[model samples]
Target: MNFKSIITSFSFTIVFAIYTINSQNTIGETEVFTTTNQAVGNITFTDTGDLVYSHHPFFSPENRVMIMDAKTKTSKPFPNKAWNTPRTTDDNYLSNVLGIRNDENGIVWMLDMAQRDHVTPKIVGWNTKTNQLERIYYLPKSVVPKHAQPNDMVVDTKNGYFIIADEGIGNGGDGTNAAFIIVDMKTGKTRRLLEGTRTTLPENTPTVINGKHLAVNGTDLLVGNDGITADANFEYIYYGPLNGTKIYRIKTLDLVNEDFTVTELDGKIETYSEKPNNGGMSIDIAGNIYLTALETNSVAVVLAKDKSVKTMVKDANMVWPDGVSYNHVDGYMYVSAAQVNKGAVFNDGKDLSTKPFYIFRFKPITKGVSFR
Candidate 1:
């Protein structure tokens, strides 16, 4: 059989296997939170247990950020409508937001790509305690290239820093350029590292979603330097490319040190075990990295001690699991399934995404890191 036929058959078999597995397992029950026809780009739980998620700008236009009531399954614009409203010349407006996380200090940090109208990228912090904007740090053009797509972020509140992944393929172009961005929380200083390096850039491999090659407009959708997370002690940052398998990490001190040369920094990078095509990632207090395995529709756990991978959960409804966040209060890892492979971006401009995108959560064996 040809590759296409093999993929089709594999997709069917995987779906059937997931159903069979879910029917047999009772320990991890996946609870789905409906998004009212909006694609959930990323999700984070507030200190009070409310769900705050971003409506992926790739497909939707209203409410770039929202807070959802778990009981009512309803959502409203977070903070206010002014920040989310799209404006051509307003510097304070939120153009596009993807990665978001709630810190222990009652602050929610959001990474705005600022792709719309070619505005500079920025990081916005909202203090949930005060229900107001805490701070906004605009990134310099040197750190965020014109075509850079800042995908995900992890905040180090204790050390006052943020690490972000730039997929580098903005507006649907070829995926070759990519980088790791480090932002100093105190000074608002931003620096780009590993730009276009083999560790940051995607391999010459096609992204297979649901066992089929994800191609749009006669080009395969290859993303780079996407999933990122920080250790519990805030000493190291872990990251991997979306289209690549190997995971890598670097010391936080080396990243922030001005004396470290690029060659020296490159030497400090430690390669971990290979992983499946993954989306968002988070590390627990025990140092285990949780990843959303997009191809197999499961959550994979990578142990810090041995760097070995194991599947935490697999379900039939996990269509293109996009982001994974650990909520300590609930003791579960929340995952957002945007059904990105089924959206218009991959379906030749025909939207195949089902309405009411889902956010699923399941309890992991290990307790999550208490960064907040």
Candidate 2:
């Protein structure tokens, strides 16, 4: 009796351990790579592996952008302090920024919303390799209308263009005015397309986090045309609203062509896949689009072939994951936990965000564009 009982107990314990190991493996590995005091808006990596990120303007941080040392974890105003300092006169300082990406040439491109100082919205590019200001392309009223919030962008150096998603909720307008803004790098010409289209506008449903609907002053949050990304080949642009349930993509060729009218371009958009209310997105070489599933506190992937949505990883602390950027140096994807839902605007004028915001990283199924 003693020998048989001992043998059976040992086997049961071994099988239980194996089952536990397998269950943990299916969830994947996520590391808390960095922590910061300021709520981060977005993040990208330079060729040298330095971490660069935007200080979300919603909280009115002292600096608009900062660069951190990978090993030391020290932070400094990116480019220099002057670029972040504000002046009464019109200057080159970044007013407010949310979108940022690193190009193949090592240029850290920042999308400055210009909401703080009432200046023109613009894209500021800082070359990391050369350590100088590369360029700044201002968006006129025609290209970026009033109440337009140019939140995120995809830089397609392969196609010689930069595309920005205007959420159209900057000051007070609803999500109906949301659209896409295309910039011609060579000529600096810009055009607004698909304004008020179904693909660009947010779903009428409120973005409910946990069990409560996000709201400010009595109006439910209506973020539009938020997360956006382009394929590695720059063939198609994929995007959806922050309060959306479906993702959409359009051919790059049809988007840039002047021949297509507004109605024609609207027809060219294809419903790519279903998704949860997400913040930022990045696409891999294999066409897997990684999205930050805000409602579920997880990262989801939309497969390229069949377009099935799957949860890749989850973390209870990763609230309101705002940005996803691929790091070519480490072959991992970095994501920022913006914690926007904890901000005062959403919580009856009381900021509930905890100190020391977190940045997480995990290995992707395949390699992705570092510049995205």
- The lDDT leader among the candidates is 2
TM-score of 2: 0.93
- How many clashes in candidate 2? 0
Per-residue lDDT of 34-98 in model 2, one digit per residue for the tens? 89999998999889788899998889999999999988999999978999999987768999999
Q: List the RMSD of every prediction in angstroms.
A: 8.7, 7.5
Worst 10 residues of 1 by lDDT: 19-28
What's the TM-score of each model vs. the native? 0.89, 0.93
- Each candidate structure's count of clashing pairs: 1, 0
Stretches of candidate 1 exceeding 4 Å from the true structure: 1-29, 33-35
Strongest candidate by TM-score: 2
Error of 1 at 256 (Å): 2.0
Query: Over the stretch 249-294, how does candidate 1's per-residue lDDT look in tens digits?
Result: 8887877677888888889999977888888888778787888888
